[model samples]
Target: MKKRLITLCSTFIFCVGVQAQEFTPKQLEQVKQVRENALNSDLSWQLLESITTEVGPRLPGTENDKKAVAWAVEQFEALGFDKVWTEPATFPHWRRYHESARIITPSEQPIHLTALGNSVSTPEQGITGEVVLFETLDELIAAPQDSLKNKIAFINYRMNRHVDGNGYGPAVRARNNGAVEAAKKGAIAYMMRSVSTTEHRFAHTGGSHYQPGVNKVPATAISNPDADQLERLISSGHSVSVNINVQSEDLGEGTSYNVIGEVTGSEFPNQYVLIGGHLDSWDLGTGALDDGAGVALTMAAAKHIKAVAQPKRSIRVVLFAAEELGLWGAKAYFERHAKSLGNIVAAAESDFGAGLIYGFESNVTANALPIVRAIAKQLAPLNIEYIRANAAHGGPDLIPLRERLNAPIFALHQDGTDYFDYHHTANDTLDKVDPIKLKQNTAAYAVFAMMAANSKNKITNK
Candidate 1:
């Protein structure tokens, strides 16, 4: 009697679970169709190849960056969207040039390094100083001003790899704030281990911050192998010195555009479902993963949905510009579209890379949770589940919309387990992205985007 009762109770719960995830029969059929089509399509790969091959790295406000904006506009129009447009995103331009680093103290050896974004150029003859090593950023901060005076601070921080990309937070702080912290101590220059998991000799380049009214210093990142070499030298109980020459041009104010495309809704045309990834990438390799995969993923999702059927709310795809330079395009997007926040049903971004999306986390209103639950159920074919994360910021490009506008955000959390290995480095090329997993991402985004557009649910709430 006890066993029978347990079995009956379990069966009841399972039935209720299925019932709670209920979608209209037509909606269920559409989800199935979208997933199947996405899985079978190679359009995503083709689109990705086009950008990475033709335009290459889209460093902020450069000529290549302008070409990227144009390419996105053309691609969106070719995809046969009902509307295509561009919005202005103006910001100061920064460009990297010839840079080199060599250890001169204990032994003479070359170290692979690259200048961080917006880093001021070093002296014409370069700069050399004794190395002051720190295991972490916190340690560097705690160092006395006199300790680092007239020296180069070497911050050797290692990043842990995780499927959820949790390690990037701790490791990236070294890149983002190390320069400012070192400058506070009167360091002549700054160098740190690349904020990546891989030990490839390629250095990772990213943005570094300098406080207003604070002295700016040249900052660079050394490859993991190079960092290891420096560490071994330090452990030998001997003083180490290095010479670094970094040249980056501040090209002054420049203009870029946020690319936009739309698939008009069949019923509630004013209501919107937005999906995108940043169009800009760091000036390394071909920008294939940092955001090239993201752009391809969202575009392919919208394309698959349009090929299958139309939804009740419009589907808008944005290929935002200047994301690498601090999400300037996204901020402009919010400023231009804040008035339409009420009409936007939901927003999502696929910026994490071309990894398989294993979960769906949303920040929509309390009432809209069930809507996403139903969407998650539809995504089961792609193995995507509904994880309880209401604070989803969609992606970096959606920050303004998600935070200031109180707009809802949905994120298809990709398995970024190895993403940092190639991120912001020359290894971030087209070959790193798996076409099969990329399509699975398209399927996941397609189902959610189409379903969100078609649903009668309201997304505007706290």
Candidate 2:
């Protein structure tokens, strides 16, 4: 009983010390105001609807990509941001013209599929061959050389659903390199189950690559239901043959721009908090859930913070370019700003869909925990929990930023259980985004950015 009393007293003292080191009451009130304003406003939804509706799919280097850049600049200017600019990024440009597949032997029926990025085109007439099924990529690799001769290799791996989207990595391995492995086995084409968690018939499309020595074959993904059908037919001892037709082009190198908007600070203008999402998305979808929500909410968050309070450090929202093809924009941004990396006091990105932010986390030095905790406290009213992992990988766009230095990074984790359902598919439209959830996401970013900028002590790297 005596030991328990001592422990309770120690806990109280530590809490009091942390509270003392954190924001003042007036600052806390400002945070409350920002949160409330964000929740009450429909700015985020308006931005999301306008961008997704007006710009449509923003595949890099397309005319739509150019329009997206102009749209972002116009929006930033209209939002009264202090400064707006663009940075150039170059990437290998590829486009899909048409993709179609169907079961030819055993039964005749259409199968839904989309060509993977960087996939080579099939012959004009397409390729028809016996179907060779592999449950996993490793199984395909282990098959004897020429085992898949005159066959189309198919991998039927399914991704599991999780709130944090942990299954994406495991399932995407096949999507990324299954084609290369299949080509090595003398396959004429490669196909796999879509890396999705949906029952719908929308085929998902994403990035894939070809190796130097290996023959480049057409890579594609079929809808989940179609994959199930193929599995059933093959399991029933039927000789399944498929015809795959994909017409695509590789346009060598192309350039895109990263749109940037800044809200300057009064005190430490050079030190900044970076937050945003990739602007470029797969052409198959409108890119609403994949990144349009991220773009809109982050843009609105900075606008809200600027309206309510003049932060001590600047806030920069970067709409990355060519992210769907690769992290090209992120790489260029970090490389161009490499010398000033240490000036980035705090950074976060929202590439996940417009789900409620369920948790807040930071990857920073021990001394920065007080600021993180204070920010988490402000986020608590929005039903966001503090994840003490201290290992926050903000988003795909921040990958380059993280690789450069031990930069201060943060993540406002959204509920991604249904994000993969519409991700990279035609179903990722504006209707999938909940306005209420977007406002909550906006409020979370607003509070986090405002507090990080206005903190008494500067956030630091680990």
Candidate 3:
């Protein structure tokens, strides 16, 4: 009976010790000061302007992507980061030569369209055939094979707007697997309604994953307006035929790189607070909002910390490569630095568009929730909320790190109501991003990153 009582007392003592280690009021005040400094800095807008104007489009495995790598290294060195370097990566080289689609029968008209990235080209003369329209993927799968044999299959999937932009997952399947599925049913070519919210005549282009051992077919996306027109023509009971010619080609393997920079910590130089955004973009538009804002935000946050010159833990910044094609850059980094994954205290990514952050979440040990909560208290003044959910999506680029290294990931949830309107479309340019909102996002990232880096607590696997 005495021994049982002693064990209970020891357990109580341990709990009390943990409670005493929580952040004090003074430490929270320091985080607030960091947030203020980030908001006042002009680095976000300035860096964005330079990248969009000078680098223009940074397609993977191309000269533009290389120039972007050089530009990032120079910029980080100029910002007085302690160390700046590049990690080698190999990515696929895809070139969009020329793309066009036209309705050949029943009042001929040209349709606005963009070829999906990494999609193969049609024959030199292009493919001309009768068009078969399906409202959804299920309808296509259930149709008689004779109706689609040697014909062009058009899949129309609509994207609905939401505050959280939850519609991207299901709507994007057409872009990813539509070609393979259509080919299995003996389809000669495939076309899909662009996955976007707006009804503009601008088509959206994104990466499509082709399953191995499946016959690949030419696939492209048409604008929402064009899809509506095509559907109307089919409803009139007239047989419609169209000509699709996409001159995309894959140049053999090409070289690319991931740029990295760091501000060494005063006390724990080996420990790291890793932050990043992918540097590669699609070829169509200027690649401004898809990732230009992300690059600018991370750079600005790191610069702000260096300007103060008193960071308690090292802040590491990585500019990933070929995120649009595949997560090659992140995969290579994890493989090369497999030994150092344990020392990586935390990892955060800024891939979503530059909108005001609404909340923060992390996939860490339950014991680490208090540390995250204390950081949240500092951001509450900016109207940001805290959610206890801890499953980390980690963005598309961080897939390798999340799967292999088991790294604790942090997500700064941003307002994405308007994100899908311009996503993967030519309309995703600089004008879409608001300067004031960009500053607000920068401030939130700076505060969270600062607090996480300085805290002595470690976010281990739950």
Candidate 4:
């Protein structure tokens, strides 16, 4: 009799737990409506095409960057957002005017290359030197002091392709600080194989920094095929000499704005869900895959949610500024709002390429798992699996937010197998994005945002 009573009690508790997370029939129907609308709508594609085409490359502090900020404000107003504004962001502005390279000895052949952001310019005639090749940055760092005097340092690290883009960090380290280290050895310039996974003859351009005491050298990236050719020439007992000319300038600190739009909530107006992507891009390409798609999809996601119903909390879409130059806008934003970070009930950013969202995960307290699981249930129909690990770092912009607070963060994992092929290169254009995949991405964000904003129980950080 006692055992039967215990079993009955356990069953009752389980039922209550299940009931605690179940959404109302009306809420479920609303979710379905939003999903269907996002899937059928071409709103995301329209926004992406408009920005990438009309605005072109939005390098930080450039004319196009100003245009992008203005464009975002105009777009927010046109979309009928409840509130729209901009926050100031200052960053060291830089520009690439021209770049050219070629092998000078053994056999003359033009090499494909581009100056890394913030790189110093070589003399008008260019800097010609014997090439000192190292397979990796560590190898270059371990070399004897002053071993590369008056030479051009080259690190040939090839990035790998992964569905999650795990190779970027390892390869990008060489791009970021390779020049500083090479300069330490008296090298006049630094070059590395592009941090890309493509065989095409296109050099990738990304942010690179110089140290205070270290001499600044001309930093650049060469196309993968060119790197391979240089490797072959060196291995065949031929001393390789090259001429590199890069014209760039670093303007003093420049100011930009982080454009933000919001949909007001019926209740809990102070609390909000943050979703957005950076508004700046590298100048080499149209910046479509790197972030234009992200900007458009997140904007459309919020609009779709507002169309269905105003959630219990607000949703804010922040188009961050100067992200490519560094996370300047995100840093300024988190610092400006440091005290009220608790208001961010949920946050996610879609900076990855417009690929199919295949998984969903969250970083929240155990008590909030019910809310997350409920959100995950709605996303399941969109083919997103619930990753119960409950540890989500979110996108790059969220790094500052994550460091500032234990705020609830989420990740809608997208398939990124081909992202690096065109990332930071001249080939990243509208044609690279598939409309079908972009639609799925839009629907996933809408479902997650709507459910997260409207859930009965508020999600809390770990």
Top candidate on TM-score is 2
Candidate 4 structure lDDT: 0.91
Q: Write the per-residue lDDT of candidate 3 for residues 271-311, one digit (tens) a residue.
A: 88888798988887777777988888888887776775556
Which has the greatest lDDT?
2
TM-score of each: 0.94, 0.97, 0.93, 0.96
Candidate 2 C-alpha lDDT tens digits along 242-349: 999999999999999999999998899999999999998889888999799999999999999999888889999999999989899999999999999999999999
TM-score, cand. 3 vs. native = 0.93
TM-score of 2: 0.97
> Native-vs-model 3 lDDT?
0.82
Rank list by lDDT: 2, 4, 1, 3
Residue clash pairs of candidate 3? none
Tens-digit lDDT string for candidate 4 (88-199): 9999989889999999998899999999999999999999999989999999999899999999999999899999999999999999999999999999999999999989
lDDT of each: 0.86, 0.92, 0.82, 0.91
Model 1 Cα lDDT, one tens digit per residue, 1-462: 655554454433223333234456777787799889999999999999999999998998778888998898899889998899999998768888889999998889999999998899999789999998999999999998767889999999999999989999899899899999999999999999999899789999988877897789899999999999999989989799999999888898778999998999988999898899999999888999989998988898998999888877899999988888888888888888777777877889888889989988888777676676778767876888778767776788878886767777788899999998999988999999999999999888899898888765556545
